[model samples]
Target: MKKFTFKIFAVAITLLLSTSLSLELLAQSAGYEVLFDGGSLEKWRSKSTPSSPIKGWKVEDGMLFMEGEGGGDIITKDKYGDFELVFEFNLTEKANSGIKYFVDTIYNEKSGEMKVNGPEYQIIDDYNYEGVKEDPNGTTSTGAAYLFYPPKNKQLNPHGEWNKGKIVAKGKKVSHWLNGKKLVSYTRGSKDYLKKKTANKFKDDKNYGELKEGHILITDHGDKVFFRNIKIKKL
Candidate 1:
């Protein structure tokens, strides 16, 4: 009878362990809204003309990808304020692309033009890409904020392999992560930010990075790049 009791007890322990493991996996996947699932583009639109249909971008083998020409920047239709975003990306040799956030598209009635731009999270082959090497500093390296806050201790996978990217924005604090490492962190609208904005290429723009809520953008930049598993969670 004692031996039988011991067997039952061991079975109960095993069941509990399995249950806990399942719950852990479920928890890790919670609180995310999938923007792209490798199947559709219902959540994205052309940044220049919001009402126009997206062109040149395609999904192949469960990955969103574009050629090295013609394809333009695409943005999320829904705007977000203070959120965490995750995505996986693969690049070709010497490829260049970017993920831009706090994107505000303003139509200029006076100039009869449409303008869309924002601070970009740089994406490129850091070692082989000419853009990084041409720069005196590594400000335009793979994980750096383009021409602004530079990421530290960069670690990127090979051009053909997929790499993980995370961007977290909560109030004034914003951070960029690549391959599970935190690379860039900065305070929005701080003195440092203002100083840099004043001198950057966006100096002419009145509201370059001042939006409290804005759309997320993926730039084409005439480079072949692939993306998948794009998800976000509001914070």
Candidate 2:
């Protein structure tokens, strides 16, 4: 009886280990890479100084958060061309931030400013933020393509709550999703895209929205925001 019991327990343990290993392998086979799992910043760097360690962002209680000013922005050290990115964020009152993809540094000759330009997945306190409240359904609202396209059918969670954000970029097409619902979708450099691009703050940036391999960035808009479960899969 003792020998039989021991055999049964060993088999159970082996099966458990096999199941866990199978799940992990499945995740990898699907091409998913975890950018942040609350532990290290090995995959990220400060945007301003790519060679240096990140500032203003910290890992606390399994979340990556911006604590104060002068943190600038942070971007992935590895650039991606076509991928699906997902993350969860929590916002403080009136907080403003964004996740930007296809990000690249550009020298704006017209304004004489060096800027990191990309289409932003706008995140803000939609009900309380003055800018968003003024134009609740406008291009600057949460889930917007940041001055390019306004999200439709958005169901934003209230301030101090968590929200899920997803971005899928493949070829010249990109889509933004909030809470598992698609909010914005557009093709870069399309006729309609060009029309909007020429009329916005990025008009002077002739290369803005052009498809290219670029880094993913988390903006530091001088507000408190938390992000976690950041993952990406190349498609």
Candidate 3:
């Protein structure tokens, strides 16, 4: 009986190891690379000064969180042309933040700050935030493309709860997803997009939203927010 029990335990251990190996292989085959899994910020850098270490952002209790404002923005060191990005975020009450892709540096003459420019996947406290409460369906709301495209059929978890966010950019088409639901999709340089760009604040900038390859940015919107499990798969 003792020998039989030992054999069974050995088999169970073998099965568990096999399962873990299979999952790891599957992720590699699917081209998924982990950018952050609560470990290191080696893959990211400050957007304004790439040479300097990140400021105002902390990694604690297995989470990469913005403690308070002035973190400046953080961006991935490598650039991607077409890819899929997935992350999880938790917002404080009335917090505002975003995940931006196809990011390029632009000199803001008004602020005298070199800012990263791109289309943003809005992350905010949708219920209590005054801006989102005022226009629940507007482009500024959570899951929207930040003044460019508004999400439809949006369902947002309340602040303090984790929400899954996804962005897929394949060719000229990009789509935003939240909590397994697709909220917005648009093609770059499409006629409708051009019309919307002309009507918005980016109209004066000819190269706005026209970049083909750029970094991924996490905005610092002067609020405390938590992020984790950031992964990207190049497509």
Q: Which pairs clash inside model 2? A: none
lDDT of all the models against the reference? 0.85, 0.86, 0.86
**Residue lDDT tens for model 1, 1-235:** 9999999999998976565344435445798787886667899998877788888899876689885467689999999989999999998999889999989778898986667767788999886887688987667888888888888877899799999999999997899999989999988888998888887888787777778989999998887889988888899
Q: What's the count of clashing pairs in each model shown?
A: 0, 0, 0
Mind giving the per-residue lDDT tens digits that candidate 3 earns over 26-68? 6677788767756579999998887888999998866888886
Better of 1 and 3 by lDDT: 3
Q: In candidate 1, which residue pairs clash?
A: none
lDDT of 2 by residue, 111-216 (tens): 8654777889998888888988788448988899999899988999988788999999999999999999999999999999999888878999876778488889
* lDDT at 222, model 3: 84
Mind sharing the TM-score for model 1?
0.85
> What would you estimate as the lDDT of candidate 3?
0.86
Q: After superposition, how far is residue 99 of candidate 2 from its true place, in Å?
A: 0.5
Model 2's alpha-carbon lDDT is 0.86
Q: Supply candidate 3's per-residue lDDT for 149.
A: 91
